[model samples]
Target: MMNLCYNMGADLWNLLRTGGSEMKLLICVLNDTDKLDELMIKLAEAGVKGATIINSTGMGRTLYNHQESALMNSLRALLDPDRDENKTIFTVVDEAQEKAFHKVMNEVVGDLARPDSGIIFTIPVDSVTGLSK
Candidate 1:
């Protein structure tokens, strides 16, 4: 189990490190796929530089809403390591240009105050190795 866990972690790290200092993960759960493309364009305008995407689904039959299903689908894709939705865009941004990154996310994503805001999140990376542009 330990070795399995290590290998899994390594694989995930390898996947993420492919981008280097420009490593920023963007998980946006939205209702409209078109909005995603629009958001991508906006990100470009905001200087996001580059991104990767992964599709996802929710597992729970019932929740506050279907958002969980979307997230669950993403988790499934992550596990399979072969499938992903173009929806979960993995954005890579350099630390020197995070301002542009946030600008992109806020400009494109819908209102978050609403109960169903379709959240967008980011995960910063400390160091990257064994990967390239």
Candidate 2:
């Protein structure tokens, strides 16, 4: 169910093991920016360099903290009606930094990856490239 949208499509093997950073193929469900800032500050205190974010949305409901706005619902019919308010973030992150990212999410966001936290999981780019850059 992992939708890997790559800028350049090659043989399926390339997707199995991501090495280099591609344009924009991987997905990431980032936590709240405020919490993210706090997380970064903590990481900064710990000597982390930096990180980035992309304004994105997801399909499920009650799956993330940042719910889908009313406007987004009108724009796309992909949301689940019966579920709680539509909220979930989609994102991409570095594979090597996966554990650290999750640690931040768990400590800062508290259940960001939980089923009803309204935030899904961040994906790794096996070979991401050309992410609308």
Highest lDDT model number: 1
TM-scores for all predictions: 0.50, 0.38
Clashes of each: 12, 21
lDDT of 2 by residue, 1-133 (tens): 1344433445353553344433222233543444555766664454333445555444443354347676776545456432333223333444434555556557776875465443445443455444321
lDDT value, residue 23 of candidate 1: 58
> What is candidate 2's local distance difference test score?
0.46
The list of candidate 1 runs beyond 4 A from truth reads 1-24, 59-86, 95-97, 129-133
What candidate 2 gets wrong by more than 4 Å, as runs, is 1-26, 43-49, 60-96, 113-133
**Candidate 1 C-alpha error for residue 8, in Å:** 25
Error in Å for residue 13 of model 1: 18
